[model samples]
Target: MNPPDVAAAVVVGGLFAAGCYLLLQRTLMRLLFGFLLLGHATNLLLLIAAGSPGAPPIIGAARIGDEPSADPLPQAMALTAIVITFALTIFLLSLVYRSRQLHGNDEVRDDAEDRRLAENQQREASAAAADPHRTNGSGQARTAADEGGNTL
Candidate 1:
């Protein structure tokens, strides 16, 4: 209802929107960023839902009838969320690093073309190796074929 609350809500909404957009990207880095943003947005939403800070939730026996204390539930929830997010981020970063190391690239691409080309090349190579008369280029196979009969 207040200006600060409205601003927080807007920021939370913006972060969620940004996270969704980044998650749709084809790069691992973008996806990591999206997850981070989403985590932050969730924390912000929890904070906004929790009332503003006042006093600690501790109460003495004699001060039991004093005033209401700050709610610790949201704060605890936020802390737990933060810890979980940290773990997730670390795991995701490791995955991204491993992927880049293995593939030499971070972007997700269709491997159908590459696989097809490799398979075609393999088939061609096998065919060439199988044919005795079809000597592959430079001397070696040609010499062997020449020594043998001119048979197919």
Candidate 2:
């Protein structure tokens, strides 16, 4: 590959890695930025995959197989990706604004049910630790299901 192609590849890789890292963050703004980076990376990747740009594919502009013609599909796909990304940006911005207005923050919150389940598990662990006979005859740790045979 040429120097420019190598640079583009490195940049695309960097953008994708950064995008994934930002997406893992627990904030709406970061998530939005991550998506933007990913979109850009995708466009770059498509452009690179389309190969070096050449003469326009105009009808009768050139003899067949005389000169390499630019691929139209990659450009079209990139344009479509841009439009979709723009729509997603608008939607995310509106969502962030709504979240700020309602909750005063864009931080993603965990579900209440998940917190409750964690608390229950902690309580069960503590109770088992405090009980001398909590273990079964085989010295295996007993679970909530074993005690009451109840499935929540």
Candidate 3:
């Protein structure tokens, strides 16, 4: 490959890494920017997949033994990706706007449900450790001291 292609690939890789780091941040603005970077990287990667450029994909424009016309498929795919990225970017922007309006910042708050589920998992793990023979997720088994109509 040419130096330019190699350099472009390197840039794409950098963008991907930065985008991923930003995506993992707790701030919505960072997330939005990260998403944009990833989208741009995707578009560039798609174009790169097309290899060397050629004459615009004009049917019957190529002469005998001449360089083939550029592939239209990758160009079309890039366009589609751009549109999808644009739409998602707008959606993310709106979400950031709403978050700012409600919370005066773009930071994502901890979800109560997520916390509850984590706590439940921790409890279950402890219970299982306490009872190695327990087969069910509840980590409880029938005992002589317990009286009930059903296991429930």
Candidate 4:
């Protein structure tokens, strides 16, 4: 392939990789940046998929039987995507701002119930370690206290 096409492909790959990495972060700001990168990558891919640039679709721009006219559909779709991405970006930014204001940080918080469950598991583990004969919620012994839940 040509140098330009190769460069574009590399850029698209880099954007996808960076976007995915940022998307996995805990902060809303990074997530926003990730989404933007992903959106741009998508737009570029759409343009590339639409084929090489050609003359504008205007009448008389290209001879009737000569050079081909550009396809308007991909251009329209890309434009629509850009607008939607902009609107969503604004909405997400406002959400992130409000989250920071309310929580004093932009990091995504863990669910309260999940935290409580993890704590409960930790406590249960410590308790079982302390008492070898203790049984858990499922009526199974923490140690080798019984076999098949029955004693001979």
TM-score: which candidate is best? 4
lDDT of 2 by residue, 1-152 (tens): 53458888999999999999999999999999999999999999999988887788677775567677889889989999999999989999999999989999999987666755665566667667778575552233235434433333
lDDT of 4 by residue, 58-106 (tens): 8756466666787878889999999999999999999999999999999
Q: For residue 54, what is the lDDT in candidate 2? A: 75
Stretches > 4 Å off in candidate 3? 1-4, 60-65, 114-152
Q: Model 1 Cα displacement at 98 (Å)?
A: 0.4
Worst 10 residues of 3 by lDDT: 143-152
How well does candidate 4 match the true structure in TM-score terms? 0.74
True-vs-predicted CA distance for residue 13, candidate 1, Å: 0.6
The better candidate by TM-score, 3 or 4, is 4
Which pairs clash in the backbone of model 2?
none
- Candidate 1 ranges with C-alpha deviation above 4 Å: 1-4, 60-67, 111-152
lDDT of each residue in 24-117, candidate 1, tens digit only: 9999999999999999999989988787755677665344455567788998999999999999999999999999999998987656556555
CA displacement after TM-score superposition, residue 87 of candidate 4 (Å): 0.3
Q: Give lDDT tens digits, candidate 3, residues 1-152.
A: 54458888999999999999999999999999999999999899999998888778877665546767788899999999999999989998998999999999989987766655565566667768877677674534222112221222
The lDDT per prediction is 0.79, 0.82, 0.81, 0.79
Reference-based TM-score, model 1: 0.64
Candidates sorted on TM-score, descending: 4, 2, 3, 1
